[model samples]
Structures are given as C-alpha cells and as structure tokens.
Target: MYQSDITQFLNQLKQQKPTLEAEQRRGRSLLWDKQPVDLDERAKQQASRVEQTPYVYYQNF
Candidate 1:
C-alpha cells in the first residue's frame, strides 16, 4: 500500500505541470483565423446560376 501511494503521488505531480515546449508543438494556435462560410455559399450559388437565361443575382442575393 505504501509503494502504491508513492507511485500515485509521483504520477499526480507529473500531470500537474507539463513542460512549455511540449505544450507549444501541438497546442491551440493563437494566430488562426477562419474564413466565413457565407462566402463559399455565395460562390456556389453564382456558379450554378451562371447558365440561366436571365442572371439572377438578386434572388439569391
């Protein structure tokens, strides 16, 4: 029981504070920005309606 307690204590300590380099390599990036989904939807709408006899940008606009 005493040996098991010591092992558990060591494991808990290791988990509390991980090193900085490991955190940086696979961590959440602070610089990431995503483009809006609406722009893609507008592009697809434009493409499909391109062949229509009357261009209808306002209907979908």
Candidate 2:
C-alpha cells in the first residue's frame, strides 16, 4: 500500500481535534456567547393615516 501526498495530508488531518466543527463552535462562542439584549416593548404610536388610494373604484369601460 502506498500513500499519496493527499493521503498523508488526510491522515494528519484525522489526528486533529477541535476540527472544523469545534473551531466553528469556538468562533461562535467567541462572537455570540452573551446575554441577549432585551428589545423595547413600547409600540410606536402614530396618528391615523389618511387614505391614499381611491375611495371609490369604478371598472373602466
């Protein structure tokens, strides 16, 4: 049996821990591991909007 360059690379890769999945987890934790900020509960009160569309629609002949 003979190992090609790619095979050797893969064999070395097989020994590694904190692999791609672990690295992703660590990165996410580093960036996103924090208490979530609370959102404002107050509703945006606005004055009643005037109608912009035609109040009466007639079919075109």
lDDT of 2 by residue, 1-61 (tens): 9999999987777677438678888999999898764444222222344455564465342
Query: Per-residue lDDT for 3 in model 2?
Result: 92
Among all candidates shown, the one with the greatest TM-score: 2
Lowest-lDDT window of 10 residues in candidate 1? 25-34
Steric clash count of candidate 1: 0
TM-score of 1: 0.25
Model 1: how large is the Cα RMSD against the reference?
11.3
- Candidate 2, run of 10 with poorest lDDT: 40-49
lDDT by residue (tens digit), candidate 1, 41-60 = 88889888845547566666
